[model samples]
Target: MEVYHLYSGGKDSSLAAWILERMGYDVKLVTISFGLLDNWRHAKETAERLGFEHQVLYLPRDTLKKAAEMCIQDGHPNNAIQFIHERALEAVAKIADRISDGTRRDDRVPFLDLPKTRSLEDRFSVAYIRPLLGLGYKTIRELTEMLFIVKIRESEELQKADYEVELRYLLREKGIDPLGIFPRRHYQSRVLGWKTEETR
Candidate 1:
């Protein structure tokens, strides 16, 4: 009954965890850190607001560095992002019987295709869950608003701890500026707290 959800302090992941908890699972929030940045505290703070047990899991730094290199070579971050996400799932699966993420139906990067999803389940002997997979942007937005207060900001704002920030830092270390490599106007949500006391 314990489900360890990969959390990022963002609306999608937050809603996913909330829904899983409501479904009778003991949802514990988890964030993956590649040891590149110290911003994981933001996620911890958000988890506190959500009233969920939270923990941080560290992934191999070398893989993240490799992913940064991938960004420069590929001229886009889709493959690198997806690579880190899948690796994160595998990392969590090692200590989780049920693993979940906030990826929605419209997410392009950091998405697990059907084959990868099945492979993850079979290889790890763990159930991978995506509570928002069947929900689109509009519905997820409405659901989040009804249950929690969220703030939307550009991805560069870094209100939440996520893999992209780490990749950006790595790219910078390699003398490759991340300003143009990643999209400029990408926006994400940060769950501040519950809009209603009863929901919390």
Candidate 2:
């Protein structure tokens, strides 16, 4: 069956795609760009390196921001991620009927209610799978290393992202674990800080 992997230009997603291809699946890479990170370049380079076909999907900034806000109001980051994932899936499924992602069981917690539990056809209106859900990050990294895949360095914006820490600080002030909430797009320090750039 044909399969398409979500290509985030991150180590996990890239390695996941590599593993699927090695297992004799006809795979392609699909990336969604928010225009904040140079994710397009990273995904493109990785696809070329792996000799896999790739495609890019772009979403409007305002739409994403509104989604993020709604997610926070709902008191969960998973909701926000699910919303974005569904959007990505919709765009990707249009091209290839089958799809997959790099999310692992550990990355998706019990509280998160990820779509992993559902069969591929249930999660999206197309065939889908997550082969790496049973594997840990370390093992995935090892596999990628063995295949000589270069890790995509975090974008300058992501490298400087303090949103997590900032959120953690805010949570600590409220006496909660910073990691409790699923991180939304606006939760990224770079995206939130864009407004302050005008003052400087």
Candidate 3:
């Protein structure tokens, strides 16, 4: 089946797309833009490197603002992040027969709650897949290490990809410190390139 995989150009999303491709699913990569700052450019570059068809979609600025507001009001990002993620999925589901994301076993925010998951499946009549849902960080690390040459960096140090980065920007613009809402020391991985047989 054709699957639209939500991609952030990070290792987890990349690996999820790779796995889906290997499993013989026709996979297309999509990056959602919340505001002016989006990781779509890097996501496009990664899609090109991985040989997949890619597209960019925009989430309404009003929706993003509401999410940011919720984050600030709650003094945490979990609910807001989940709201944005679900909205993105809902948007993608309209255009694709199946939708997937890189949400892993341990992901906190941007994860669909059980009710939301069931609602999407029932209402949309589309499958919502998360290939990495059963895999934890350790297994993901080992898989990436075995499959690709990767560079690791703190999420804050990266080139502003992913929803958290954009959300952080939104928070800052409103004079709310992101660090107060988000945890410290989140890390993201970039796939430098594929590992060759000789290196393996």
Candidate 4:
């Protein structure tokens, strides 16, 4: 079946797509853009390198700002991030019957709660899949390193590509410190041009 994969152009999403492809699923990568600020460029580039059909869907600027505002109000990003993620999934569900994301077992924020997960599946008549849900950080990192050549960096430096990055920008614009809301030391990876010959 064709699966619309929520892609971030980061290691985890890339790996999820790769695994789904290997499992013989028809995979199309979809990246959500919140208004003007998004990692669409990087995501498109990575999709080209990985040879996947890719597209960017836009979310309203106000929606993203509201989510950011919630984070600011709550003094934590968990709820806001989860809200944004669900919104993105909702958008994808409209386009495909099979929806998936790069969310792993170790992920905290942006994870759907049981009720929300069931609601999404029931409402959309779609299957929500998380291929990396059973994989730990070390396992994913090792697999990523073995399968592709990547450049790692602190997630903050990855430009306007991630939801957190946009949220941080919104918070800063409102004169709030994002550091006070989010945890320290999140990392993101980019495909540095090629996959290993072994994975070919």
Candidate 5:
């Protein structure tokens, strides 16, 4: 079965690609570049290292700028980050449609939550598969090691940059993890602006 995997060059996505290939499925990799210097390099190297045919989708800067503005105007709880993420997903979904889906065209987008950002992009047509959800970061490391997969070296620009750490730092500054106020998926909300009410 032919399937297209969203390639982020992260441990999770890399491991997902490895697992899918081992399962006897024909998987192609697609990476969307939002013009982030660090992200572009990472995606390029990961695709080459794994020897998978990869394609790059360029995202316009204005799209991101507009998303950021919408977040601020709408009082999106997280700010500009979430907007960027949603825009990326939307861009990927559009690209995914252009690619032919052989067997897995019905695959669905896996979201940490049920709603909110669920429909930001259409993953079904791309046959998006989330094979790494059952696996943790440590397991991903072990698999890469066992399979001799080369770990992606972070660019010097991102050497000390950790988005999760940055998120917590801001939460600390705000004196709130805001769990009681937002849904679980919004754990990244501090980084991505979408906010969800717990009861909803």
Candidate 6:
């Protein structure tokens, strides 16, 4: 069976795709862009490096705008991000019978709880899978290290093509400084490619 993995060119998503592939599922990386930035190309490149078929899905721009507004209203990025993630899940459900993501067990934001996940499955007749939901930070990082090379940095330093980057852009367009809303210390990763023999 084929699984369309929502990819962000980050460590978690990359690792999730690898795990899914190892388990015998054909994994195709899909990056959702709300038409704010062309940064989704970062994920496309990383997907190629990882040897997974990849595509960019241009979604409704209103979804991005609403999430940005939610950030300003809520004074945090968590719920807004989760809202966007849920929307993405719903949209992808229409494209394939199976949808997957990199959301981890410990991740608080952009996650689907049991009830919500089940609801999505029931309503869309789709199988929602997040392979990393059972894996924590250390285990995921260790496993990623064995399979791929990644670049890690504070999110401010132009990290991977995660949604936050575009969300921050949209927030700024709405006259709200992202620094005023988003946490400053958050770090993210970008998967560069597979680890060659010498590096591994």
C-alpha RMSD values across all candidates: 1.8, 10.4, 1.7, 2.1, 11.8, 1.0
lDDT of 4 by residue, 95-167 (tens): 8999999998988877886798999999999999999999998999888887877878876676525677778
lDDT of 1: 0.90
- Model 2 root-mean-square deviation: 10.4
Query: For every model in order, what is the number of clashing pairs?
Result: 0, 1, 0, 0, 4, 0
Q: What lDDT, from 0 to 1, does candidate 6 have?
A: 0.89
Give the residue spans of candidate 4 off by over 4 A: 198-200
Better of 3 and 5 by TM-score: 3
Q: TM-score for all predictions?
A: 0.95, 0.63, 0.92, 0.91, 0.54, 0.97
Flag regions of model 5 displaced more than 4 Å: 35-39, 66-79, 97-112, 116-127, 148-200
Off by over 4 Å in 1: 197-200
> lDDT values of the candidates?
0.90, 0.57, 0.85, 0.85, 0.47, 0.89
By lDDT, the candidates rank as 1, 6, 3, 4, 2, 5
lDDT of 2 by residue, 1-200 (tens): 67988775555566677678878888888777655444466557656766788877776655456545654577665555566666666667667777787777676421124454353366456766677878876886566555543423232234332112223334455565434464433322111111133333
Q: In candidate 5, which residue pairs get closer than 3 Å at backbone N, Cα or C atoms, i.e. clash?
A: 78-193, 79-193, 82-192, 82-193
TM-score of 2: 0.63
Which pairs clash in the backbone of model 3?
A: none
Ranking by TM-score: 6, 1, 3, 4, 2, 5
Q: Against the hidden true structure, what lDDT does model 3 obtain?
A: 0.85
- Top candidate when judged by lDDT against the true structure: 1
User: What TM-score does model 6 achieve against the real structure?
Assistant: 0.97
Query: Which candidate comes out best when scored by TM-score?
Result: 6
- TM-score: which is higher, 3 or 6? 6
Q: For model 3, how does the per-residue alpha-carbon lDDT over 39-107 read when each residue is reduced to its tens digit?
A: 668778877877889999898988889989998899888898888888999999988889999998898
- Tens-digit lDDT string for candidate 6 (1-200): 98989999998999889889988999888899998899999999998887889998887998888888889999999988998889888988988989999999998888888899999999999999899998888998789889888888888786567789899998888788999899998888898998999989
Report residue 5 deviation for candidate 6 (angstroms): 0.6
